[model samples]
Target chain A: MEQLKKAIRERGKVLSDEVLKVDTFLNHQVDTHLMAEVGKEFALRFKEDGITKVLTIESSGIAPSFMAATDLGVPLIFARKKKSLTLTDNLLVSQVYSFTKQQTNDISVSKDFLTEDDRVLIIDDFLANGQAAFGLIDIVKQAGAHVSGIGIVIEKSFQPGRVKLDEQGYRVESLARLHSLEDGKVTFLDETVSVQS
Target chain B: MEQLKKAIRERGKVLSDEVLKVDTFLNHQVDTHLMAEVGKEFALRFKEDGITKVLTIESSGIAPSFMAATDLGVPLIFARKKKSLTLTDNLLVSQVYSFTKQQTNDISVSKDFLTEDDRVLIIDDFLANGQAAFGLIDIVKQAGAHVSGIGIVIEKSFQPGRVKLDEQGYRVESLARLHSLEDGKVTFLDETVSVQS
Candidate 1:
């Protein structure tokens, strides 16, 4: 978590409107070492939950999900942004609107992958607006799977992501929480958590 | 490679138009343990290439790229399917047409992540038409980066992927190259590879 926070401080670029570009480590270009640390934190946070699978949206969330799923020794199901020829006809589909892209996208997982017997841990890179996480949770719920927990690497608490999920009764844990990005300066919720920098 | 090959044979379903769906392991639903094996194999294969970064297209390619990049201790940069707010004006863009989606998508990478001094190895989950790989190579070339090699987990040799890349003088390596899928029986070009089932 310290490594991630350090990476965020050093490599993260605070754009206008609370957009933090961490292409150097988190989303576009992944830092496997920091991700491992984040994965360990997620596992520690949800070790007793008996997570059956790790669910995430396409692209950005796949890396952290990979590390967490591996640590939990569970399969990670990523909802594809576009429906490929490979996906099954029987699926749990949810519509998610990405404010970043300014478009509505359908995210889905096969009905065969998630079942009532399964408990899912949803993971992602950033929790902004909580649209992607909610979409994944919808898919899990469609299959009658229990939402064991939601793990995030970096969360923008100033946004309504955490508040929204909390209202939905989902336990959310984020390693790094940003309080504000006013005037291009990143202020952490808990600066003491900045151990690696 | 054996594990991937087994996953392809066991869980991989052959559709009407030569689509091999291995959603259970490599793509939609990822097996983290199997992905670790894939990462290890890619590390062994490209260890001598002095790869500074691992590149791939978005979605399915992100998972294998994570495994390979983590094992190699390198940065993994995936060309996004579309431009998001996180993307900057400084980018290297390439046009890729997906036959499955029946649409042409532009793949772009931020210029800051890749440099002329960087040695890149492109990794992807499948190699069918080679359009996406070509797009990734074009982006890398546009950034003046050197593509050390191309690593694919599965190659449908029944297609023109290898031929096009071979003509382009790129080093393309596939862990499992399919020879045929006649009568629903999937056969590999290499004997050392065995299906898990």
Candidate 2:
């Protein structure tokens, strides 16, 4: 977690006061070594949850989720953002709004993948508005699966995402929590605040 | 490789004469253990090449590429299929036609990620027309980077992808090459046939 905060400070770019672009290491071009460490952090946090599966959205979340799933020794199911030719109709669908893209898209997972017997851990790269995570939780609930916990690489605590998930009674753990991005600078939540809240 | 072949034979579905869907393990829902093996296979094949970075497209390619990059002990950069707010204009872009979706999409990588000093190995989930790989190669070339080789999880040998890459003088190593998907039965190229040709 300290490594993640350090990476955010050293390599992360602040596009605007609201957007922190971690494409250098977190999303677009990834540091697999850092990702492995992030995965280990998540695995350590959720080791006793009896997680049967790891679920994440396509694209950005796959790498970290794959690493975590590998460490947790469970299968990973990524919810598809687009309905491809190979994706069948028997799927649990949910619409998610992307603040970065400024558009709404449908996300889906096959019914065959998630079942009532499965305990799902939803993972993502960044939690901003919580739309994507909420969408994934909706799909999991639709399949009658239990939501074990949520693991995030980076979170914008200034946003309402964390509070929203907490109000819904979900255990959310993030490696790095950003308190603010003001004047093209990133301010992280203190360790005590991050852990206590 | 044997594990991949066995997974295909057991779980792969022949959607049509041309489309063999292995979403059960290779893509959509991934078997992390098997993917680690696939990664090891790619690492063993290209271990001699000085691979500085592993490149692939987003979504499906992230899982396998992550494993391969982890095994190779390098950074992995995945080209973004769509332009997002976070992706800047300083990029090397190329167009790729997807036979599955029947659409052409622009793929781009940040100029900061790939440099002339970097030696890249492109990895993908499946190869049919070699369009995605070609596009990735184009971007890598645009950045003046050297491509060490290409690794694919599955290749449709009946298609022109393999021959096309061969004609272009790229070293391509696929874990499982399917000779045919005719009659709803999947047939794979023999070990000798796969290695020699």
- Candidate 1 residues B68-175, lDDT tens each? 888789888888887877685898999999888888988899998899999999999889999999999999999899999999989989899888999989999898
For candidate 1, lDDT tens digit of each residue in A106-192? Answer: 988889899999999999988989999999888988999899999998999999989999998889999999988889988888863
Interface RMSD of 2: 1.0
Q: Report the error of model 1 at residue A179, Å.
A: 0.6
Which candidate achieves the best DockQ against the true structure?
A: 2
Query: lDDT, candidate 2, residue A13?
Result: 89
Over B24-133, each residue of candidate 2 has an lDDT whose tens digit, in order, gives 88678999888988887888888889999999998889888887888899999999999888786998999999888889999999998999999999999988999999
The digit string of per-residue lDDT tens for model 2 on A125-194 reads 9998899999999999999999999999999998989999999999999999998899998898884344
CA lDDT of every candidate: 0.86, 0.91
Q: Which residue pairs collide in model 2, if any?
A: none
Model 1 / residue B167 / CA error / Å: 3.0
Every candidate's DockQ is 0.74, 0.85
Off by over 4 Å in 1: A192-197, B191-197
Regions of model 2 farther than 4 Å from truth: A191-197, B191-197
